[model samples]
Each structure stands twice: as structure tokens, then as C-alpha cells.
Target: MCKRVTCPNDGKPTWWGCGAHIETALAGVATADRCDCPHVPVEGNPRMFEVKKTEDQATA
Candidate 1:
């Protein structure tokens, strides 16, 4: 089953689970409050969780 989680990028509500259960996990979350950040694969990392670097951080 999917679980509701906070988005690391914007601190908005998001899901952490299988793709199939995404909808179920965010069923009651408001659209505006939901995190719509696209998932980008981390280079040199093959793990379940990934840390995304912001634009400023990337350029630093």
C-alpha cells in the first residue's frame, strides 16, 4: 500500500510507495497542496530514496 509523505523539495504533501497505489495514497489531498515535482533519477545511485538538489545547489 502507498503512504502519504512530505515532499522534500517544497514541503508539500506527496506519496511514497508503488506507482500503482499513488492515487490511493493521495486520495484526500488537495491538488494545490500536492507536490508535482518530477522524479529524476540520481546518477551513481540505485536506491529506493533519492535526494534532489535544487537549481542553486546544482550550480554551486
Candidate 2:
């Protein structure tokens, strides 16, 4: 099995951007170890997230 990856939101290192994103990434990493430094999210994490569907949101 592969290790979970890090979050793109991370700003602590690398290019150095989006502090809020980094914070969220840090927290996610702590819980599911889905962060890049330790785990690779693609390994065992959900590929997609849940979002509310709207009738008007859909377009032809």
C-alpha cells in the first residue's frame, strides 16, 4: 500500500502561499495522516468530496 499524500492547501513550506490552506492541511494531516509529509491521501482517502446538489446549479 502507498502512503497518504499532503494537502495542496499547505503553505508552511514549498512555494509558501495560502496560510489558511496550510492550517487546514495541517489539521487534516494530524487526523487522517493525509498530509504529504507523512501520508498520501490518494492512497486510501476519498477521491471526491460531498457537496449539496441544487436544481438551479445544474445547467444544460
Candidate 3:
């Protein structure tokens, strides 16, 4: 099953993973929080559940 999280910046569902890690991966840029929708993290990091996926949709 695939999971995703919402980037509070741009209001998009990024890949499920650590938000801080994603932020750091983006070189500590605000854009990290505003990543495009469906942003799947290729690696792991801290702050995994800072922002989470919306429960409005059902997974297959």
C-alpha cells in the first residue's frame, strides 16, 4: 500500500515519510513543505507524522 502526506505550504499530498527529512532533503528550504502532490520519499528521516495524509479518500 502507498501512503502520502499533505505539505502545509502548498496544500499538496506528498509521499508518506518524515516532513523534516523531506525539508532537509530540499536543503532546508520552505519549498520542501510545498512540494508537489504525490511526493513519495525515496528515503527515511525524522518528523514522519508532522503532516499526514487525508482520510477522505480510500486506499485500494
* The candidate that achieves the highest TM-score relative to the unseen native structure: 1
Candidate lDDT (C-alpha), each: 0.66, 0.32, 0.45
Residue-level lDDT for 7 in candidate 3: 60
Off by over 4 Å in 2: 1-46
Ranking by lDDT: 1, 3, 2
Measured by TM-score, how close is model 3 to the native structure? 0.26
lDDT of 3 at 32: 43
lDDT of 3 by residue, 1-60 (tens): 224455654565444544545544444335545555453334354434344334444231
**Candidate 1 local lDDT, 1-60, one digit each (tens):** 567877776778777644557778789888887888765544654333333546865676
- Candidates 1 and 3 compared: the better one by TM-score is 1
TM-score of 1: 0.61
Q: Indicate the residue-level lDDT of 57 in model 3.
A: 42
- Give the CA lDDT, 0 to 100, for residue 21 in model 1: 75
Candidate 1 error regions (>4 Å): 40-60
Against the true structure, what is each candidate's TM-score?
Answer: 0.61, 0.19, 0.26
Whose TM-score is higher: candidate 2's or candidate 3's?
3
Error of 1 at 38 (Å): 1.2
Evaluation by TM-score, superior candidate among 1 and 2: 1
